[model samples]
Every structure is written in C-alpha cells, then in structure tokens.
Target: MDPIAPESADEVFLTAEEYEAVHAAVRTVAGSRGAGQPQTLNSLFEQWDELVHEVEEGYGWSAPELSNDLGCRTALAHVWRLLPPRVRAIRQPELDEIDRRFHATTVGWPGRDDQEGQWWLRRVPRHLEAETSQRSTHGWPMGWDVMAFPKPEAVEIAD
Candidate 1:
C-alpha cells in the first residue's frame, strides 16, 4: 500500500534521508558528550529539552510538509527508541528519589486519576519501572518507555 495516497490520511512517509536526518540530530543530542558514566536524570532532562529544538530544526530542514500529527508521534517514538544508553541508565539513589516523588505527586494531585495523571504516567521511563523491584511494590504502566524526568516541585513538598 502506498503511504502518501489520499486514502492513507493517517500515514506520513519520510524519505530515507529525512528519517536519517531527524534521528541523527536526536542521537547527537543524546550522545553529545560521548559515553562513559550514565547520564544523570537532571542532565538527561536538559538534553531532552535540547532535543526538542533539534527535532524541530531537523524537520524544518528535511521534511517540513511531512511534519504532521502522526509524523510528530513517529518522531517522538524514534527519539525514545534511539535515546543513548548512557542517558537511559539510572542509579539506585536517583531511582529512590523518583519513587518518592511519584508517590508524593499522587497525593493531593487533583487529577491523579485523570488525563494529567495519564500524561505524567506516560512519561515514566522503562528503566525506572525495571528498577521497581529494588524499592516499591508497583511498577510503571506497562509498555512505557520514555523518560519521565520528575518535576522538582513535586518532590520538594513535605509529606
């Protein structure tokens, strides 16, 4: 089936060059400093912010017309999948802090059972959940893979 046919409204096809350009820019952001120590959560968070800009530039230069809704999702999934190994790694202490913040956020968050909560939950990274056996009883929602770097405000509150 052809991807760009009028009947395939939900599909957006990228040229091989476009796909490579977009993903390469994202990978560069993920590995800018080379690999060694695992990237800190805070550093990864900063890099993710930078990556957003890079993705925009990549799409702007490579395939502006193909940058539709589905294309955006594709780009995000690609970014998540291509995240550097160093960036995906998290240590025990940071994992503990993530658990603490997750629990704290649930308490008093009016939208805990609503879309906002779902959005927050969607960002929870697979590595974070994989480490769950080391701390708490629950794991992140199944199939989650993106890094959900915690908001500092959520963890700063005393419970």
Candidate 2:
C-alpha cells in the first residue's frame, strides 16, 4: 500500500461559502438523533451527507481522498455519538481552547444600575471582620469624660 501525502493549506483554507456550509453541516449533525429513545449511529451517515454538502458547497473543502484534519474529525465527533455500539472517538485538544475562548462568554451578573448607557454591577461585601455601627447614644462624648477632670484652675471666685 502507498502512503498518502498531506493536504496543503492552499487546498483547505476557509472561505465564506465553506464557513456557511461547514456551519450548516455541523449544525445538522449536532442536532441529528436516532429514532430510539436514546438514539444511535444511524444519523452518522445522514451527518456525513451534511459534510458532503458542505464540501461540495466549496468552503475550500475537497472531499477526503486519503487524509484529513480537525475539520473532518469534528464532523465525525457528532457522527461518533450516533454509532451503534460505537467505541471509537476523536479527542480534541482544542475543545479546551474553544471552551476557554468562547463558551458561555455571555454569562455574568447583569448590571444593577443600567442608566444612561452605564452598566454598574453591584456586589455586597461577603463578610467584614471588624465592622460595627456607632451607637446612637445621645450624650457625652470626649469632652463629657474630660469634664470629670479637675477644672484647670477654678476661675478664682469673684470678690
């Protein structure tokens, strides 16, 4: 058997059409499920049809002749889910990267004050160790206790 040569980047860079097509195929494959309550691999070929459409639509994809890359593997990631008694799967190192970069990016506390295009997020301090409110005592302060100290010099009694 002969060894296959690798695909050059010139052959596979993404185009707008390719983007749309691959997007559509991946979307379809992602959504496909079998008739079984749990579903199985029957939809994989259906998913492959999707992949073929994407390739034919020219998102810079040529049909796989001998070898492939993450793109094909990603398509099959969905396909793998559909396989009956499926054991094989592709592991994506970049799934971590994609999760890090893009997953749940829209999640966060919404601004408490959204006025005049300003979004102010409000958070209360969780716990303060040495916090206490001043007592509302109505009387003596610093001078009150000082009054107890002897008058510096009693004003000499007036004659």
Candidate 3:
C-alpha cells in the first residue's frame, strides 16, 4: 500500500520526535487518577481544568496558536476522548453546576454577559462533542496515528 500524502502543504503531520514530545506534554498536563481507583466527578473536572489551561494558554499572543496546531489539538482531543463513559455521563451535570455557581456569584456584576461567563465552562464539552461528531462522520482526523506510516488503498487492475 502506498502511503497517503498530505493533500496540501497546510496540513501538518507530526514527525516521530514531535509525536513523542506532544504525547508527553499531553500526558503531563492530563494527569492520571490512580491506576485502580474509580474516577469521580471531581477528578474528571480536575482533569478537564488542567487540559483547558494547557490548550488555552497564550490566548492573545502572536506566537503560533496551540489550539489550532494539529499535533497539540489532536493530542488534546485524544486525551478528552479517553474519558470513560461514566465520566462522560457526569459531565453535563458538572458543567451545569459550574454555570450555576458562576451565575450565582456574578449576578449583578457590572457588564457581565452570560455568554462570556459560561465560555470556559462550555468549552471542553463543545470540543469533545465536535471531535466525536467528526470522528463518526469522517473517521479519525488525519495524523491521529502519527507513529504509523500511511497505508495505500489496494488496487485491482481489471484485464
């Protein structure tokens, strides 16, 4: 099978070194919840917080955007997708509670827009849903498996 080439120069493929670096950064940011321990909502929320902080840093900088970089985005998406079904199930209520608390305290604060207040709370869930939908529709994003060489489709020439 011939390897699949990037259709354009704009597409980013991680080299072996870059893949390892990104993988390590992701793991460092998305810390583990003890090997055998059951994941609680708090633990999951903590993980979400850490992941968001890492991805959303340098928000106004002119430097390369971490949120849009293929390797960083894919690595973060991979971590988000790894959350177990039970943890995913609890996400909405947790998010709702966060929104509730934010609004509860911020009520009557000057110029506080609901959308602005809720943006952080909603970001991860929105990203996860988009990634899940894309995966279902288009299969995994290209460069998802950075370590593996692309495989070409089999062809049969008709005589």
Q: So what's the TM-score on candidate 3?
A: 0.24
Candidates' C-alpha lDDT: 0.33, 0.29, 0.34
Q: What is candidate 2's lDDT per residue for 1-159, written digit by digit as tens?
A: 110112345332344553444435435565534453322232333343443343333223211220232234344555444432212221133233332322122121233342322111111111111212321142112211222222222111111
Best by lDDT: 3
Instruction: Write model 3 residue lDDT over 32-80, tens digit each, in one string.
Output: 4468543332444454444444333312211122224223223334444
Which residue pairs in candidate 1 have backbone atoms (N, alpha carbon, C) closer than 3 angstroms, thus clashing?
none
User: What is the C-alpha lDDT profile of model 1 across 60-90, one tens digit per residue?
Assistant: 2211222231233333334545544433232
Lowest summed lDDT window (length 10), candidate 1: 123-132
Candidate 3 residue pairs that clash: none
Which regions of candidate 1 are displaced past 4 Å?
Answer: 1-41, 44-81, 85-87, 91-96, 105-159
For all predictions, the C-alpha RMSD in Å is: 18.2, 28.0, 21.8
Give the runs in model 2 whose Cα sits over 4 Å from its true position.
1-38, 60-159
Question: Per-residue lDDT for 137 in model 2?
Answer: 40
